[model samples]
Target: MDDVHAVRKPRDSWWTVFLVDPVACRLTLLVADRTAITPNGLTGVSMALGVTAAISFALGQLAAGAALFYLSFMVDCTDGKIARLKGTGTPFGLWVDYMGDRIRVICCAAGLASGQYAVTGDVAYILLGAGVTVLDLFRYVNAPQMKRVREVVRENRAQREPAGEHLARQDPAGENRVPCDPGPAEVAAVLNEAAALIREASAQPHPGAHRVLRLYRRIGRFLGRHRVRPHLMSGIEFHAAVFVAAPLLGSWALLPVSTGAGALLLLNEIFLIYVLWLSTRTAPASPIPQRLPV
Candidate 1:
C-alpha cells in the first residue's frame, strides 16, 4: 500500500488520477511482486495491446476496441509506476514508451477512419482521422518547445534578479524548499496570481474574467487536494474522450465528442500561452549589473 502510494506521481492529469491510477498502481505492485518483468517488457506488452486495439477498430469493433485501448492505457500507466518503484527505469525504455504512444495514435486513427468510411461511405471520417493525428502531433511537439521556452525564461529572470531577491521571490514564507516539489498550495497561489496579473495587464479586462478565474481557482483547489491538475482536457483526457467515451456513446457521438475534446485541448493550450505571455509582460525589467572600473 505504501509502495503504491509512493509510486503514484505527485501530480497527474485528472483522467489518469481518477480512472487509471487506481488500477495501474495495483497492477504495478502485482507485476513487481510476481514477475521478472522489466519496464521494457511492460512497454512491449502495452504496445501489443495498443496494436490489437487498432486492429479491432479496423474491424469496426468499436466497443471491443475501446475496451482494449483502455486496458492498453492502464498497462501503459503501470510500466512507469513499476519502473519508479523498482528503480529500473531506462532511457531506452523512455524512448520506446514515447514512440509507442505515437505509433498507437497513428495506427488507431488510420484504423478508425478506414473502418468508419467503409461503413458510412463518407470522406469526413478520413478527414477527421487526419485532423486528429495532426492535432496530437502538434500537442506533443509543442509541449517540449513550450517547456524549453519556460525554462529559458526562468533562467533569464533568475540571472537578471539579484540572488537574494530571487530566493525571496521563490520562498516568500522563508521556508527551505525541495528543488522541484512545490506543494499544491504554492502552485494554486502562483496560478491565481498569474491569472489576476493577466487580467490586469489586458487593455480591457473581460468582465467575466474574475468570475472565471475564481471558478478556476476553486476547481484547481479541489483537484489539487487529490494531486490532480486542473486542466481536465489535456492530451490524456482528450485521447480517452475521443477513443473510449465516443465509442461507448455509440458511433454517432464520435465526431462531436472528438471535436469538443479537441476544442477544449486548444483552449487549455491557449490559456497557457496567454499566462506565459502575461508573465513576461508584467515581469520587472532589471538591467544586468556591470563591474566598476578598477
Candidate 2:
C-alpha cells in the first residue's frame, strides 16, 4: 500500500492535461482500473524526462529538446492517469507533483540562462526576463505569508457588506472581482451541481454536449460579469509554454518563430499583473493552520 493518504475527491474535471486535479483523476482512475502502474514510479519517470529535456534544451539541441519536452508532458499525463487508476494518488503525491513542476521551471531557467550567458554571449534581454522570472518565483514562494497578511487585512478591514455591495465589486472583465464567500450550505449546492454535470458529461458521447456548452457559456458570462477569472493570469501554464517556445523559436535557424513567440509571451506577462500580485491572495487556508500576526 502506498504510504500516502488518498486525496478526498477534489473538484477539477477541466484539468485533465496536468492530471494533477485529484477528483477528476480519481473518477478517471476508478472507471479504468485495469493497467496497474504505480503513480509515484511514473512521477519519477516523468521528472527524469523533464530534467533530460531541460538538459537537452540547455545544450542547444532544439530538436531533441522538443521531443523530450513532449515526452515529459506524456509522462506527466500518464502518471496522473495511472494514479487515478491505482487509487494511490494522495495529497503527498500532489506535493510531489508540484515539486516536479518546480523542477521544470528551474529547467526553464537553466535553458534560457545557458542561451543568454553561454550560447549567445549576450546577457541583456535574457537577464531582464530572468530577473522577472525570479521575482515571479518569489511571488509563488511567499504566497503563504502573503495570503495570511491579506486575510488579516480583509477580516479587520472588510466590514460585512449587504448584498447590494456585490454590485460594483463584481466586474465581468476580470478586473477587481469582489469576494464571494458563500457559506457551507451554498458551497454544498455548488458542489452538488458540479458533480451532477460531471455525471451527465460522463454518460454522454460528447462531454462537451449542448448542456455542457450552455454551462460553459454561462460560466464565461458569469466570470465576465464578476471579473472572477481563475487566479492564474500568468499561471504556470503560460509560464512553461512560453519558456519552451522561446528557445525553439529564437534558435539561429528559427528567428521569426523566435521573435513572434517571444513577443506573445511578453504581451501575456505584461498584461497579467493580477497573477503576480495575488499568488498569495486567498489560497485554501492550510489544514494545519498558520499563526496570525498580532
Candidate 3:
C-alpha cells in the first residue's frame, strides 16, 4: 500500500490527483500484486475501452459514453502507476501510452461530433469537434516546445554565470535538497523571483498583470503547502471538462460547456506562454541551438 502511494506523480493535474489517483492507486496495487499483466498490456486495455466509449457516443448513448470514457482514463492512469510501482516502465510503454491517448481523443472527438450532429442536424457540432481536437493537439505540441525553450534559457543562464554561481542561487544555504518535496518557502522564493523578473522586463507593466501575478504567487504558496500545483485548467482537466462534464450535462449543455472549457484551456495556455516569455526576457542572451540534442 505504501509502495503504491509512492508511485503517484509528485505534481499532476488536479483532476488526476483528486479524482483519478485514488481509484488508480488501488487498481495498480491489485495488478502489481496479483496479475502478470504488463504496463503495455494495460495500455491496450485502456485503448480498447476508449474505442468502446467512442462507439457508445456514436450510438447517441451520451451518458454511457461519458462513463466509459472516464473508466478508460482511470485504467490509463492505472497502467502508469503499475509500471512505476513494479519498475517495469519502458520507453516503448511511454510511446504506446502517448499514442494511445492521442488516438482516443481523436476517436472520441469524431464519435461525439457525429453523434451530436446526427441528433440536431446542426453543422456546428462538427466544427466544435474539430476545435476540440485541434485544441488538444495544440496543447500537447506547444507544451514540449515551451519546456524546451525554458531548458535552453536555463542552460544559457548557467553558462553565463560564474562557476558555482548557479548552484549557489539554487541552494544558497548549502542545505541538501529534496527535489520531490519542495517546501512552501522554496516555492514562494521561486515565484517571487519570477515576479521580479517580469517586473524587471516590463518598463510599465499593467496594473492588472501585477495583480494577477501577485494572486498567482499567493496561490502558488497555498497550493505548495498542500503539495498541489496551481494550474487548475491543464490538459487533463480540459479533457475531463469536455468528455466527462459536458456529456453528463446532457445534450442541451454539451456545446456551451465544451466551448467554455476550450476557452479556459486557451486562456491558461496563453497565461503560461506570457510567463515563459517573461522568463526568456530575463534570461542571459545566447543563440538558441539549431536543434535539441538527442
Candidate lDDT (C-alpha), each: 0.73, 0.47, 0.77
Q: Specify the highest-TM-score model's number.
A: 3
| Predicted candidate 1 versus true structure: per-residue lDDT over 160-257, tens digit per residue | 76676554455444222211122211233334444544444467554455455556667766766788777868878888997889987888998999
Location of the lowest summed lDDT over 10 successive residues in candidate 2: 179-188
Worst 10 residues of 3 by lDDT: 176-185
Top candidate by lDDT: 3
Question: How big is the positional error of residue 158 in model 2, measured in Å on the Cα after superposition?
Answer: 10
CA displacement after TM-score superposition, residue 121 of candidate 1 (Å): 1.5
Which whole-number lDDT from 0 to 100 does residue 106 have in model 3? Answer: 89
The C-alpha RMSD in Å for every predicted model, in order, reads 6.0, 12.4, 4.7
Q: Model 1, 239: alpha-carbon shift in Å?
A: 0.6
TM-score of each: 0.83, 0.52, 0.85
In candidate 1, residue 52 scores what lDDT?
Answer: 92
List, residue by residue over 65-139, the lDDT tens digit for candidate 2.
Answer: 666765565566556656654567798988787688677666755675575456677665366446535644654
Task: Report the number of clashing residue pairs per model.
Answer: 0, 8, 0
Which stretches of model 1 miss by more than 4 angstroms?
172-218, 284-294
Q: What is the C-alpha RMSD, rounded to one decimal, of candidate 2?
A: 12.4
Clashing pairs in 2: 29-84, 29-85, 171-226, 171-227, 172-224, 172-225, 174-227, 249-258
